[model samples]
Target: MNQAIDAIRTFNRFFTRHVGAIDARFLDTDANLPEARLLFEIARLGPVLANVLQAELGLDRGYLSRMIARFEERGWVARDRLDSDARARPIRLTQAGQAAFEEIDGRQRDAVAHDLESLSATERDDLVQALTRARLLLDRQAPDAFTIRDARVGEVSQVAARQSVLYAESHSWGHGLEVVEAETTAAFLRNSDAERERCWVADLGGVMAGAVFLTDEGEGTARLRLLHVEPFARRRGIGDALVAGCLDFAREKGYRQVVLWTHTVLEAARRIYARNGFECIDTQVHHTFGEPVQGETWRVLL
Candidate 1:
């Protein structure tokens, strides 16, 4: 553990120096790294609460307040009282702030591009993969780092393929399961109602770590399907987040109940479903996926 700690500290020091993080002016801008980061955060998360920002950045409350005061003095940001909570004020970037953030972002991008230009394409790819793995390992220790969002175009197919591959490797399932996944995904895409059907991908950092889908099952019922978490991303609350997001979306769409089907052998998924208030409604042995397996249907009333 001590050796690991020393190694991490060494890397932190090297990375800070390599990125010119110790420089007073970041990307040749008037704002330092912290200030520039604050501006970027403000731009990314519009109208963010100051307290939230302070907590996220791990800045002292007074230091953050002073920084905001400086931004306000420079006409770069504004704070407005929340109507729902008058005592709480949210900070937002001004026109000048947005322009400044853009400049800083462009410069930072250029700097990164310049640094990567020295590496071959394959080397760059390896670097990216290594970084992704590092982030996944680190983020697994930080529960709040995971985010659930709508899956982007072309990602649904990828999710389906990943699920098929993972299941085949983990459970000795054959191509039948893959065929079923493909057909279901295709049908969902072809016949889904945008207002009723939704799919969410859990992202750890920039990687798609898990996915879940909710589709209309008629009679005000929503079916949860294609739920999966990558092997490297398990035990980090990602499955729970995906399931919860599905149930929340179902509730919002006026679903009277949400249902799911899973194999009894998938104990982790079963635990997730049960923890989310789903009750086992039925179980039957089936030789549908190349083997005799007990398929269980679970439901939760919203």
Candidate 2:
């Protein structure tokens, strides 16, 4: 209890000192924190809709409207309607707002620098290590779990749509480039209850960004299909996590061999597969999107 109390006190002191307490002089009352933060957010992600800000920031609509009005009055922001839908307005920072945001951002960084300078290098490293350990513990203690239900009902449509776009763009294929139909994918998800096939979706913050599926071809062989991570979720280790989940499930189902088919052009996927014990076992030359391409087959022993 005493140790915990000490830690809490340390955290409070750190927060107060670094994040500006009532008596803090670094950030004067030139503007309220909310307005300053709003300015920064607008400058960082301008041309973003007000609805998006409200959702992302959990701000009340009335409050957001008031802030936006203030920004507009100051000539710091401009609102424009979408070309396709004039009713939908997006807010963007004007030149004046951008300049103000840069000034505020510089000040914020300087404040952080001041706080960091007060700590010795070893102390800073120690603080970082502690924070990292705490973060990992929190993540493991409450792993962000997505509903592991049958994907075919409605969610598979989402996976198919995004996956189709990814493949179309990367392969330069136009129109009707979706490799798998929704009906087929839905059937696969629906039939996977017995582990004869499986599709797993990793919902990060309520969005399906990572997925891996398995299809049993019978005769002791299983195929890993549709292993993909959405572009926004890349580099977050979601892809690896999804693959690991799929492999664990496949192994538990007594699969002897697992195979995956992917284009050789996708170096990131290939690297991930290789790191996860998949070896390229076959390759075929084919024409896709008016260009010659090589498709590689990778296999792993369960």
Candidate 3:
């Protein structure tokens, strides 16, 4: 643990130095790093409440107030009292502040691009992947880091292809699972009812981290299908969120119960089902996916 902590600290020091974070002026801007960031946030979320910025940035209230006052004095920001609540005020960036933010943003981008230009293409790719993994690990702990929304156009095929690749590699399911996924996903898209059936994708910072679908099974029953989380994105409560989303949709649609089928080897998914009140109602030996395995049917009352 000590070694790990030391390693992380070393990396932090190196990274801060690499990015010129120790300098008072960030990217040759008049404002320091924190001040520049505050300006950027104001530009991005203008008409946003000051307390909202304080909570979002984890800044001390007095410190943020002072910073805002400074910006106001510079004629870069303006704050207006809320009509409904006089105590609450919303902050906005003036034209001068927007220009400042744009300059900082452009310089930051150029700095990053120049640094990346020093590395080979392969090294740059590795750096991006490493950064993605780091972000996924760090952001997983935040409750609002992942969001569940309806799948967009062409996303169904993406989900099916991802599931096919993951299952084939991890479970030795071969091409049969891929064929099934394509067929099932295509059918769902072709005949889906917007009000009664739904497909949800869990996005983490614009990446599709997980997905699940609740389809009408007729007879007042809903079928929960294709609950999948990317291998790197597991153990992040995404599976739980997807399951909860399915169940909530089922309840909203007035379904009497939900059912799902899964193989015995999918222990993580099975655990999620069990925790969500699904009971394994039946098990049978099956060779559906190029292997002899125990198939289980689970059900939950809505």
| The candidate that achieves the highest TM-score relative to the unseen native structure | 3
lDDT of 1 by residue, 200-298 (tens): 999776678899999999999999999999877888888999999998888888899998899899999999999999999999999878779999999
lDDT per residue for candidate 3 within 1-302, as digits (tens), equals 99989988999999988887888987778888889889988888888998889988999999999999989888889878987999877899888888888899899999999989999987886687577767777765545377889998878888899999899888888788888899989999999999999889988766678899889999999999998998768877899999999999899889999999998899999999989999999999987688798999999987
Q: Is candidate 2 or candidate 3 better by lDDT?
A: 3
Q: Worst ten-residue run, lDDT, model 2? A: 141-150
Whole-model Cα lDDT of every candidate shown, in order:
0.88, 0.74, 0.88
Worst 10 residues of 1 by lDDT: 136-145
Q: Which model is ahead, 2 or 3, in terms of TM-score?
A: 3
Ranking of models by lDDT: 1, 3, 2
- For every model shown, what is its TM-score relative to the native structure? 0.60, 0.50, 0.60
Deviating ranges (above 4 Å) for candidate 3: 1-106, 109-134, 137-144
- Which prediction has the highest lDDT against the true structure? 1
Give the deviation of candidate 3 from the true structure as CA RMSD: 8.4
The sequence of per-residue lDDT tens digits that candidate 2 reaches over residues 1-302 is: 99998988998898766676544233763456778878877877878999988886789999999989988898889998888999988899889888878877888888878877999987886676565445544455434444433453466667777777877777765444464445547777567555467777866544465677788877778888887886655667777777777678778888898898888888998888888889999999866445677889999998
Answer with 1 or 2, whichever has the higher lDDT: 1
lDDT of 3: 0.88
Cα RMSD, each candidate = 9.4, 19.3, 8.4
Error at 1, model 3, angstroms = 26
